[model samples]
Target: MVVALARKKIYEEIADIILSEIKSGKLKPGDKLPAITKMAESYQVSQASIREALNSLKVLDVIHVKHGQGSFINEQMPLGFEQNFEIITKADIANLLDLRKIIEVGCVRAACEKAEAHHHERMAEALGKMWTAVENNELGEQADYDFHMAIAVSTGNPLLANLLEDVSETMIRTMKETRRIWLYETEKSIQKIYDEHKLIFEAIKNEDAEAAAKSMYDHLKGVEDVLLTNY
Candidate 1:
């Protein structure tokens, strides 16, 4: 007897179609994708699903959105980048967090060793924005992700930065989950996150690799605990 595969969600199906088009050279680099309405009509899916599919492409760096323009394929995107983003799953949040811990903790350590004054300044700025957002009762998810990306960029490793960027969708999901948990379940949890980020930044600023890695690990562990326990 043969087992049937699970049906793909409409958005996922759209995403796969777009990916296949790109891989087949039907959508070349620097080419702007068709409008959402057009794509929806073509694929016989809702515009919302087409939008989601385009967002997934953005997450994978297969395309970049330009406001007032349209989504254009990344000129420098590597071949087969879509393969890296094919395995989207709701149940993979925990696994994504685990992978994040591995990659980001390593990035923190490397940042401590290799980061320059400008890199430290960038992280500090992102940290400041995060604090401001928390004070304003906003999620500050973008700043949070930027702070982490700064650490990765500080490593001066394009490959590492690309690796982290490739997982942008999952990272954003994890960040939103972190904020949601803190906003609803844990009181004053934003303060705790602020303090953790401060510690991580300071360790990197002081060029303490072990401390940076430990601080990053602890920060991620706290988020992981919240996710695993509540989610």
Candidate 2:
């Protein structure tokens, strides 16, 4: 009984250790993790404990298991989560969007508090590019990404900025998909995207953290709705 309990506790600890390695970038997407037997030996734990840890990671989408081949880190995996755009299900997309919203809302709130005049200027410039893109019938994904990334940078938080950078592939992918849908399926979605970003910019310019966070949420909520419901 005591050994079983010890194994349980050690498995959880081992899982966290592996997760931390992935988050710290020691382990990367598509990187084949050590074999379970090796991991068990390295961690001084039983193979059962290592197996349990890897199983948990698989459940969280941190790793993919092949029957004969060793487990590999998921390419779509997020930093702590996973920002892979090549998702298999709508639920995966929803999970990514939810996490993106959490990070962005916090960044917007912080940007409102800390962003400088130049930061606001950069966002305005990005918005201008977005407008031009829409007028030209382009997706403007880069500009859209830059605008949000600028907001994260404006917060003066490297961690937040890195998080945004880490999930950029997901952001760009979602932007392209949503833009295409809005253009072909919905009307005035281009304008709506511009308007939403404008709201976020205005709130930041006015230094209203609460308002900025809300606008960001509303903007993202719209994207989530379109993708999940319409697309």
Candidate 3:
């Protein structure tokens, strides 16, 4: 009994360390975690101890298992139109979308409330880069990612920034869904986003806290409308 209790303590502590690293993006999605033996050695514990902790994470859906491939981080899940139509059950995707709506909106609002002019400038730059990438027909995905993440960083709240990491594949799913509409709209929705984001940036630049918050809220609401109506 004493040994069992000790092992549990060791496992939980090590688990916390690994989880924190992943949350900080030091261990990103699809990164293969160290083998059980390596982790055991790193933590100065028995292999059984590390395995037990990894097992717990697996149950929590924080990691994935493969028979011959070894353990790795689970990539974000897809809630995009493609996923809705062909990847998985719509019901599961619906629940996932609802969760993302709550989390990201809350984070963006918090970021808007706290960010500064320089942050807005940086965000604007990211948007410009995204547009350039789009015109080039290259993947503007990372630019889109950076703009939102810059806001999260500006929030002065690491939790808001870390939210994406903990959300697993939900982040990927959201981008996939949002981008699908953008890729095939009648009007240049890209320009529309460029304008909306410019307004958001200007609001932040001018220190219009209420306006910034409301603009972000409204923008996200529009995203929800698109996802619901189209997909």
Against the true structure, what is each candidate's TM-score?
Answer: 0.63, 0.62, 0.52
lDDT of 3 by residue, 42-137 (tens): 888999778767754553446666656777886862223112121222344456557655665565566557777777777888989877866775
Clash totals for all candidate models: 0, 5, 2
Give the Å shift of residue 118 in candidate 2. 1.6
Clash list (residue pairs), candidate 2: 76-84, 77-82, 78-81, 78-82, 78-83
* Residues forming the 10-long window of minimal summed lDDT in candidate 1: 82-91
- Where does candidate 3 stray beyond 4 Å? 1-113, 116-118, 137-139, 185-188
For each candidate, the alpha-carbon lDDT, in order, equals 0.80, 0.81, 0.63
Cα lDDT for residue 41, candidate 3: 83
The root-mean-square deviation over C-alpha atoms between each candidate and the true structure, in angstroms, is 10.3, 11.4, 13.5
Better of 1 and 3 by lDDT: 1
